[model samples]
Structures are given as structure tokens and as C-alpha cells.
Target: MKGIVFLGERRLALVEVNDPTPGDGEVVVEIKASGMCGSDLHPYRALQDLSRPPESRVIGGHEPSGIVAAVGRGVPRHVALVGDRVMVHHYHGCTVCRHCRTGWPQLCEPITRTTYSANAHGAHAPYMKVSADTLVPLHDSLSFEAGAAIACGTGTAWGGLERLQPRGDETIAVFGQGPVGLSATLLASTRGSRVIAIDLDDDRLAMARQFGADETINAREANVAEVLRELTGGQGVEMVVETSGSPQAAAAGLQAIAVWGKVCMVGIGGKVTVDTQAMLDRQITVMTSYTMSTVAQKSCADFVVSRNLDLDRLFTHRWRLDQAEDAYRVFDAQVSGKGAFIF
Candidate 1:
């Protein structure tokens, strides 16, 4: 089997590797499609420190969709079939911990293991293994590309919106035009919130409009906070989804949030400086959201099944496993609109 290995320092290589066999409570999946997430770029760019040395290369992807090939001993046969198409949670929690019991595995107790990017080998290869607890069955109608996205990008948006709890009548400002940002805009609009999308790229802004943004702001040309303020009649937005991950964008989002409003930080940007005094004075609530829970992932999957989300539109480009290097280059340059690797 061939997999993409990250050798650190912005280095990625496609190399042949041994296929994985499932262990107890785990299953081996035949890779179908893997989506490149914005968060994946952090490690690709060396923004996050590697937990291990460079010599111990790790498999590079997490957002994968595949068909169940085999189940390990002691795994329940009813959980999945040999031919079932599914998506993995990408991260599993220690079922014994308080957080896991309460349904937040991403904050697993002890926090030693993570799917794909950490201790476990991720899905950047021909085959990968995952715990049955993290696997979700995909409907026949959903594409592998769509299923791949459910692991992170779409799930993150769903988690963020769940935290913010945007109402039908309230307005939401999504400050970023990347895949995750666009996913938030689309989901917010579907929930009947008026979505305002802010981004520097015209292409992404146009896509945001297509996804249901009531208005789009070209942050490079105009003042984002002022535009949002004017759009909200000076009261500011009822809720702000900060997906730009930019320090300035965070500050602007804080400025554009209505008093007592909620701000959900979903983007992975540089270190930001916030005006704590102003936030306290305005009585605003700021929260951070990460990966979705199994329950939340189920909800998101249901939403996709019910709403028939336009996953095809979100899949702007596709590459084969052999094209992994080129794919990273395009993603690093932010050239491909919404890219994925198809087996």
C-alpha cells in the first residue's frame, strides 16, 4: 500500500507502506476518498510542533471515506458489514474518562492519542484502521468525498453552530471564506439565519453567496466591522462566527458582535490579542469549538441526508494518491478551491 508520509518541515512524500490489519474493536477500511482540511495545513506548514521527532514520519490525512474491508476479533458484526461505506470519527476517546462519558472525545482523558496526525496513522494511504466506536455508516446517496468531509470540515461547522445556537431570526457573520467557513455559512443559512460572509477572495465570496450568504464583504477592499455594523443597523450581528483565524479578524468580529451576543471562534489563525475589558464591558460571550461529537456527527450526517447538501459543489478538485505531492502544493498555495484525494 502507498501512503503520504509527513517528514516534517513542510516535507511530504508518497511511499509504499504495509497494509494495516484491524485489532480488537477496530476495522480496516479500504480508502476511497480523503478531504484536505484547513487544520491539516497547520502541521503541513509546521505551525504546530510535532509531538515526535522528524524521523518518525506519520501518515498525513484524517478526513477519509472508505469501505469496510475487515473487522477485528471481538468486534460486533452488527456494527458494520464488509462492504459498507463509512466515515471514521478521526479521533476516539477513552471511554472510561469523564469527558468521554459526557460525549466529548476530542478532549479525551490523558490526551495521548489522535487519529492520523498524532499517535495513530491517518488515512493518507491505501488502507487505514479505526475503532468501531468512531465509524459512521454513510447513506448510499452520499459520495465518498462528502463522507470524507463529515470527519472534520463539515463536522467542525456543525459543532461551532451548535455552540453558538443561532436562531432563525438572528443574523450570523462568518469571518472567513475557506471550506470550513463556507460550511458554517451554509449550515447557518439552512437553519434560517441571515448569513453575512466576510473574505478577501472574490471567488470564495461568490461561493458563499451561492451557499446562502445574504451579503458578502471583501475584507481586502472595505472595513469588515463597519460593513457588518451598517448591515446590522449599528447593533452589530446577533452572532459572529470567526473562521478567518486572523488576529485582526478576531478583533473585528468582537467589534461587530452585538452586546450580549455570542462569538464562536472556529478558524485556526495566528495568536490573537483580544480586548478583554471591552468584551466584559459589552457582556459578550466568546466561545471556542472544535471537532463534533459522535451524536453531533450523526446529526450532521442526518442533515446531509435530509437536506441533500450540495457536496459536489464543495468538491472543487480531486487528485489520486500518487498526486499527493501536487495536492499539497496546490493546497499550500490555496489554489485549489476545495480539494480532495480520490482513490
Candidate 2:
């Protein structure tokens, strides 16, 4: 089989590798579509959070949708039969942990899970092996690309919305117009909430408007708090999802919410210096969101189908497996919208 490997220092290469054979309680999937995400940039830059050294050469895809080609020993029949389409939960954790028991394998208690493109073999190849429990059925109606997204971008957005539980009566502010941010906008709007989107890029801002943002703010040009305050009619938006790790956006998201409002942080990293006094006085709620739990992933897929969301519009670029290098270069530049590698 052939797969993509991160050679460190912003380098990626498609290399030949042994075909995956599932172990006990595992399944091997013939990948049909795999997504390139912001998190993949970490390994590309040699950040080393989860990726192993150059010698081991871990594969570099986390979100994938594919057909079941083989089931390992002890694999359950109810999960999927041969030829069934499915999405694998990117996080592979030790099942014994309390977190894993709740279907949040990404938050592995002692951190024993094998993360894609880091410690374990990822899906940017012809075949990938995953534990049976991580499998989530992909409805026959949804495209493989959409199924792939459910494990990462879409799933992360759903996780934030599930936790925040935005109501139609409230206004939502989503910071950052990345894939996760766009998903938040689309989902909140579909739920009938008035949404305000914040981002520096005009292209992303435009995309946000199409996704149902009532107003768009370019943080580079205006004070987000002021604009948000103005848009909400002096009463700040009740719910805010900050997907931009920028300290400025993070601080503004908290400050622009109404008293007792909730702020959900879905960005991966960076620090925000909070106003201790203001936070205490406002009776605010702030949640630091991680990746979606396994339950959340399934729920997101169901919701997407039920609502008939047009997420296919968000994906702007698609490359073949041979074009791995070009794919990351464009995605790393962040000039283009969401991109994927299609089989």
C-alpha cells in the first residue's frame, strides 16, 4: 500500500508501506476519502505533539471515510458487514478509562490512545486499521467526503453546539471562519439562531454569510466587541464560539456576551489573559471544548442528514493521493477553503 508520511520540517511524502491487517477487535477499511485539517499542520511543522520520529514515519491523515474491507478476529457483526461505509473516530484510546467509557476517547484518562499521524498509522493510504468500537455508520445518502468530515471538523463544531445549546431566541457569535467555525455557523443558523461571524479573511467572511451569519466582522479593521454590541442592539450576543486561538478574539468573545452568557472555546491553542474581576461579576460560563466524543460524532452525522445540510459547498479543493504535497502547501497557506484528498 502507499501512504503519506510527514518527513518533518514542513515536508510530506507519499511512500510505499505494508498493507494494514486488523488485529483482534479491529477492522481494516479501504479508504475512499480523507481530509486535510488544521491539526495536520502540527506534524508538517515538526511540532511533535503526537507524531513519532522520522525513522518510524507515521501516516498523516486523521479524518477518513471508507468501506469496510475486512473485519478482524472478535469484531462484532452489528457494527458493520463487509462493504458497509463508515467513519472511524480519529482517537484510539484505552477502553478502560472513564473518559473512553463515555465515548470521549480523545480525552483518554492516562493518554494511552494512538493518535492518527502521531503515534499510530493514519488513513492517508489505501487501507487503515481501526478498533471496532470507533466505527460509526455513514448513511448511504451522505457522500464519503461528508462522512470523513463528521470525525473532525463537523464533529468538533457539533460538540461545541451540543455543549452550548444555543436557542433560536439568542444570537451566536462564531470567531474564526475555518472549517470548524463554518460548521458552527451553519448548525446554529439551521437551528434558527441569529449568528454573527468574526474573521480576518474576507473569503471566509463571505462564506460565513452564505452559511447564515446575520452579520460579519473583520477583526482586523474593527473592534469585535463594539460591533457585536452594536449588532445585538446593545445587548451582547448570548452565545459565543471562539474557534480563533487569537488572544484578541478570545478576549473579545468573552467581553461581547451578555451577562450570564456562555462562551465556548474550540480553538486548539494560544493563551488569553482574562479579566478576573469582569468574569466574576458577569456570572459567565466558559467552556474549553476538545474534539467530539464518539457519541457526539454519531449525533452530528444524524443531524447533518436530518437537516440536509449542504456542507459539500464548504469543501473547495480536492486532490488525488499522488498530489499530497500540493494539497498541504495550499492548505497550509490558508488561502483556499477546505480541501480534501479523494480516492
- Computed on alpha carbons, the lDDT of every model, listed in order, comes to 0.83, 0.87
Per residue, candidate 1 scores C-alpha lDDT tens digits across 1-343 of 8778765566677767678989998899998988898777777777434675543677878897999999998778788779988888888777768877665778888774466556788888879988877788887898899888887888889999999987789989998878788888889999899999988889889999999999999988999899999999999998988876888888889989988999999888656778889889889999999878878887898998899787768878899988877788887775346788888
lDDT for model 2? 0.87
lDDT by residue for model 2 (185-290), tens? 9999999999999999899999999999999999889999999999988989899999867788899998898988999989876698888789888888999888
Any residue pairs clashing in model 1, and if so which?
A: 116-122
| Deviation of model 1 at 235, angstroms | 0.7
TM-score leader: 2
Which stretches of candidate 1 lie above 4 Å from their native place?
47-55
Model 1: lDDT equals 0.83
lDDT of 1 at 132: 78
Residue ranges of candidate 2 with Cα displaced over 4 Å: 47-55
CA lDDT of 182 in candidate 2? 92
